[model samples]
Target chain A: GAGVSQSPSNKVTEKGKDVELRCDPISGHTALYWYRQSLGQGLEFLIYFQGNSAPDKSGLPSDRFSAERTGGSVSTLTIQRTQQEDSAVYLCASRNYNEQFFGPGTRLTVL
Target chain B: AQSVTQLDSQVPVFEEAPVELRCNYSSSVSVYLFWYVQYPNQGLQLLLKYLSGSTLVESINGFEAEFNKSQTSFHLRKPSVHISDTAEYFCAVSDNEKLTFGTGTRLTIIP
Candidate 1:
C-alpha cells in the first residue's frame, strides 16, 4: 500500500511570493495533518482535517497559513506572502486509527 | 492545553549501549502518547505508542515506551542501539485529534 505522499520535495521562492505544498494521504485514512519543522522550533502543528468535520485551524501560526482537504483525500497547504521565518520542512501525515503515517516532507526555503 | 517537553535536545550514545529519550507531557485530561523517529531527509515513522490497557508499549524494532500517568511522562528506551539508530526522535501527546509535539531529540550513534 502506498503511504502518504508529498510533492515538490524542495522549493525555494522569494520572501513575498506564495507557495502551495501538496499532500496525498493513504487510502481509507480519514485524518490528515500538516506540521512545520524548523531548525529552532522543531516541529509545530499547523492544521488538521478529520473526515467531513471542520478542519482544526488552531495550530496555524498566522492568517497567511491555511490548508484545505478536497474530496476527503488530497490536501494543500498554502502560505501567502511567505517570510524568511516560514522556511522549514512541511510534513504531512494521515491516520486511520491511532498511529499516523507520514510523508517525505517538502522543504520550503524563502529567500 | 496539552504540551510535550523533551528535556534533551540531543543524545549521543555508543553503539551497543542503552539509550533513553525522556518525554514529559502536560494535559488537563487523559492523553495518548507516541514516539516517532525521523532520519535525515525523510519523514517520521511511528516508533511506539501507549494507548490503553497497559502502561508499556513496544515497537518491532526493539524500542519501548512506558506511559506514567502520575509523572505525566512517556519515555522511550532501548536496551542496545546500533549505528543505524542515529536520527531525530519526537515525543507527542494527543488529547484530541491533533497532537502536541516536543522539540525533538537528535540521537547520534558513536562508533
Candidate 2:
C-alpha cells in the first residue's frame, strides 16, 4: 500500500523568500496533518484538515504560515517571507481512523 | 488543548538490552495515543497505538505501549533492542482529529 508522499525532499531558500511544500495523502484518507520538526522546536503541529471541514489552524506559529487541502487528497503548506526560524523539516501525515501514516517530509533551509 | 511530552531527550542502550521510552500527555477528553519511529534521513512510521479495548498495544517489531489513563502516560517498551532500533521516537495524542506531538527521543543502540 502506498503511504503519504511529499515533494522536494530538500529545499534551501533565502530569508524573505516564499516557499511551498506539498503533500499527498494516502488514498481514501480523510484526515491530513502538517507538522514541523526542528532542532530547537522539536516536533510541533502546524495545521490539520479533515475531509471538507475547516482546517485547524490554531497550531500555526505565525501569520506567515498557511495551508490548503484540495479535493480532500493533497495539501500544500505555504510560508510567506521565510525566515531563519522557519528552517525545519515539514512533515505530512494522513489518517483513516486511528493510526496516522507519515510522509518523508520536506526539509526547508532558510539562509 | 492537548499536549504530549517525551521526557527523555536521548537514550543509549547496548545491543540486545531492554529499553523504555517515557511518554506523557495531557488532554481534557479521552484521546488516542500513538508512538512513531523515525530513522535517520527518513520519515516517521507508526510504532504502536492505543485507541480502545486493552490498555496495551504492540507493534509488529516487538515494541509495545501501555496506555494509562489515570497517569496520563503511554510509555513504549521493548524487552530487547537491536542496533537497528536506533532512531528517533515520538509520542503523539489526538482527541478527535488534530494531533499533538512531543519532542522526539533519540535512541542510540551501542553495538
Candidate 3:
C-alpha cells in the first residue's frame, strides 16, 4: 500500500467485549508503532516494533491491552474485556524511526 | 523518558494571520523532534521534522520549526495561515524510537 492502512474505521462494542484492530504498514517500513488518542488525553504510545523486535511495551495501560507485529509488516492490537475507558482512536504509524506515516485510525467506542 | 509539552490547548487566528504553536521537551539525551497535523477524522500528516541538520527546518507548506537546545523547544510557526490550515497539531519527541507526544493544540483559523 502507498500508506499505512487500518481496519474497521469505527467499532462499537459493549462492556466486557473484546475488540481487535489491525494495521498494515507501508512496504519496507522497518518501524511500526501503535498509539491511543483519547479526549483530553494526548496520543499515548502503546507499543513499538522494529523489524519484528519490540523493545518497548511500557505504555500499555493494563494487562488487557496487547499488540503484536508479525512478518514485520502487519500488526494487531487486542483489547480484552473492553472497558468504557478503553474507547479511543487507535492509530498505527510506520516509519524508519525518522519520520512516521499514520493510518486513518480506528475509532473504538465501548458502550 | 522524554516527554513533550504543547503549551496551548487551542489557538485561534484569523485567516492569513501568522501563528505559532508552542512546544517544549524534556530529555537527558539528544532526540528527534517532529510536528504532525491531524485533520478531522483523518490520519496524521507529517508537517516537518528536526533530525540533525540546521537548527531550523521548514516544511513544504511554508511551516517552519526551530529546534532550540537551550529552551528545549521546537515551536511550529507559519507566516500566514489559511482557513484550510485549521487542524489539530501535535508535538512529538523520540529519545530513541519510542515517541512521546504532547497534548494536541487545536488551531482554528477564523475567516
lDDT against the true structure, each candidate: 0.91, 0.90, 0.92
lDDT by residue for model 3 (B1-111), tens: 688998799999999999999999999899999999998767899899999979999999899999999999999999999988989999999875877999999999999
Predictions' DockQ, in order? 0.83, 0.84, 0.85
Look at candidate 1 and tell me the lDDT of residue A63. Answer: 95
lDDT of 1 by residue, B1-111 (tens): 999999999999999999999999999888889999998767898888888989989999899999998898899999999999999999999865888899999999999
> Where does model 1 sit among the CAPRI classes?
high
Worst 10 residues of 3 chain B by lDDT: B93-102
Interface C-alpha RMSD after superposing true interface residues, each candidate, one decimal: 1.1, 1.1, 1.1
Tens digits of lDDT, candidate 2, B1-111: 889988899999999999999999999898999898999877888888888999999999999999998899999999999988999999999886877889989999999
* CAPRI tier of model 2: high
Q: What fraction of the reference interface contacts is present in each model, in order?
A: 0.89, 0.93, 0.93
Docking class of 3: high
* Model 1: residues with Cα > 4 Å off, grouped in runs: none
Spell out the clash pairs found in candidate 2: none
The 10-residue segment of model 2 chain B with minimum total lDDT is B95-104
On the 0 to 100 scale, the lDDT of residue B75 in model 3 is 97
Candidate 2 vs. true structure, TM-score: 0.95
Writing each residue's lDDT as its tens digit, candidate 2 over A1-111 gives 498889989999999999999999999999899989899988888888987554678889999998988898889999999999999999998988777888999999999
